[model samples]
Target chain A: MATQIRELIGNHKILPVSMERVRDEDDLYELGMTSFASVQLMLALEEAFDIEFPERMLNRKTFASISAIDRSVSELVSGRA
Target chain B: MNVAVNPAALTTPALERMARVADEVAARYAADVDATGRFPEETFAALKRERLLGCWIPKEYGGEGLSLTEICGLVARLGQACGSSAMIYGMHQIKMSSLIQHSVGSPWHLDYMREAARDQLLLGSATTEGGIGGDLRNSICAVEVVGDRYRLTKQATCISYGRAADAILATCRRNPDAASSDQVMVVCRKGDYTLRETVDWDTMGMRGTRSEGFELVSEGDARQVFVQPFSEIAAQSMLAMAHIIWTATWYGIAADTVVKAQAFVKAEAKKKPGTVPPGALRLAEVSASLQQMKSLLVAGIARYEEALADESLMNTLSFIAELNTIKVSASQLGIAIAQQSLMILGLAGYRNAGPWTIARNYRDLLSAAIMINNDRILGNTSNLLLISKIDVSVA
Candidate 1:
């Protein structure tokens, strides 16, 4: 899941910085992830995992980092199971 | 005058009142308004007097709370009389609809809506910024926060009727540290903001809109910022309503041109006792196109109304793609109808001073595709088509 999240972020054009320099704990916004880009990433993640982010999960903190997104998805997937 | 009223509807009286006002105010001032390239003050005054400016605000907020279909109908009627007035009014309703849908629970926005209802305030939008490559979702300006108050300075690409508007809704970076696309929508009243002209309003059509660029500086309470994410607002309400209402207005322009063409055909036939005028056949063809345009608009509006009722559906990828397609189709069809009408009218339509002159309609309808750029819409649609799960072909 973490590998997939990292791969998605790496390919998202909105994140202009090189993916090699980005750490799992790095703040996506600080790394140049725009709100519009974050929404795009969120959509991409949802498609990959087949999980919808509820309204409560739509905040800056949810997409703060790849690790954060991975945790959110894991929790949602586990809860559904 | 006993008109049939739908039990589930609330717009009968409102629509009738708007029609009367359109004739008295919009049509009355339209020519001079266009000639001078000035704001349609008389039409706006009539709207305020009839309290139609706040038609979309909820009844609890002191508005009639008309449905999307009714608002589109009213805008279409106004468009027939004055395209400029209809566009301005439609833009205002678009902003109001966003606030109502996204910030309804916030006390500040609720009070703002009530105040707008009480004062009939005209709201202007400053979303398009200079040096942003015409992207509405990104802003070059950033809002600076000093304690509880925030200050914003933006080089707005255009603010339609900016000087005359009671308040302006400006977009900027959420905070000084936020990303270029992490934006907030702030409502700044007239006294709170000052404008310096950056661009002029001379244009080929919709001259009465008076859209001009300006350097805007404003300060307001931090709470005036909308709480919802700008992305959510854009996807759920702003894009859909703007496209729908603008399409409605363009439909109005085409429908009116067709009406005048039909009148001209009848007048020409009267010259020769029993023979049909050659232009009548062309008019018939254009009228068929006009019907198709109306059907497209109606179908789009129905889809939007359904989304309004179901909040969850609005966030889906397929729905957004569908809305974009509607905009592209409407923009293309509007120009086609206007061009066909001009062909039908021929020399009469070509002349600026004749009864069949559709010069203004032709010019104004041309702005539909270029305003948001249909190419951009199609590009976005292409991307969404790859990922959208719903098969749009089924229905």
Candidate 2:
């Protein structure tokens, strides 16, 4: 899940930084992930995981890092399972 | 099952009546509006008198309940008379459509739509901000919540007909803490907001639009904030409608230029008794290009209608790319067709302030490409192209 999240972030091109340099715990916004890019990343994540981020989850904290995204997705997926 | 119908069928007698009123107003004030860089008050008043401002809102909401096709035709006809009026009308419809679709269950928007239907309110959009550099999806200003009320202050790079509009639909970050892209669209009545002009609008064309920059400040009930995400709104309706209707209006400008060109050719041929005017062939070519422009707009409008029926399809990246491409294509074709018309008429079209003159049409059409900047659209399309798996080639 972490690997997939990282891949999606790197490939989404919302951030100016490259994928390899984007650490799991690094703050995506601080690393150049713009609000526009975050939306793109959210869409990509939704498409990849087949889960919609509810309004409550649509905050800066949810997309702060690849690790954060993976954790959120895991929770949603586990809840559904 | 998708049923395709001629978009023109969407027009009704009421729309035709409004178009006539618009035409009369445009005929009287278009030139002066262009010359003075003033809003077309007469044209807007005509629209209001005809109750055409609420054309796109649902009938349940006290509007005409016109479809996108009908709205496109109405805007196109208005464009044929005056670019500024058409653009202003188009922007209003775009905002109205967004509210109708995205704000479905929200009582505030519904009530607002009903009021707009009754009042025929002219709406201004303040999405483009100064520091953002034309990236509409992001904003530097945000909604500041204070108790039950929300305050917004934005340095809008441009607000079309800002001073003239009765209300504004402005965008800002969902909250001060939200990301620049996590924005919400807020509704502000003219009395609710204050504007200080930041820049003057003096341009070569579409001058009547009077798109001046202003610092917009508004404090309103938090309920004015649309509940849906801006991203969802853009993906579903706003972007597509803006592109489609703008395309239709651009087509209208081009069609008018062709009409003038044909008249010029016919007049020249009449003087010569039997010989064809040298420009006759060019007129035919321009006519063909005009047909192509119409096809692009029709295809775009049709696709939008189809997507409108299917919520799932509307949310996809593929649909977004298709709409953007249509915008880029329509804008380019509009400019090209107008340029061709100018060439066909030569000095006659070049002359300012005459029956044979297409100078305003030519200048107005030039604004299409730079309205949102075609290159930016192309770049976004290219990025989407990298991910789009849909086969674009015709069988």
Q: Each candidate's lDDT (Cα)?
A: 0.83, 0.82
- Give the docking tier of candidate 1: incorrect
* Residue-by-residue lDDT tens digits, candidate 1, B271-368: 99799998888988998888888887888888888877877567565677778888888889988988888887888898876677888888888899
**TM-score attained by model 1:** 0.87
DockQ of each: 0.17, 0.10
Could you estimate the TM-score for every candidate?
A: 0.87, 0.85
All-Cα superposition RMSD per candidate:
5.6, 7.4
Residue B271 of model 1 has an lDDT of 94
TM-score of chain A for each candidate? 0.94, 0.94
CA shift at B340, candidate 2, in angstroms? 1.1
Clashing pairs in 2: none
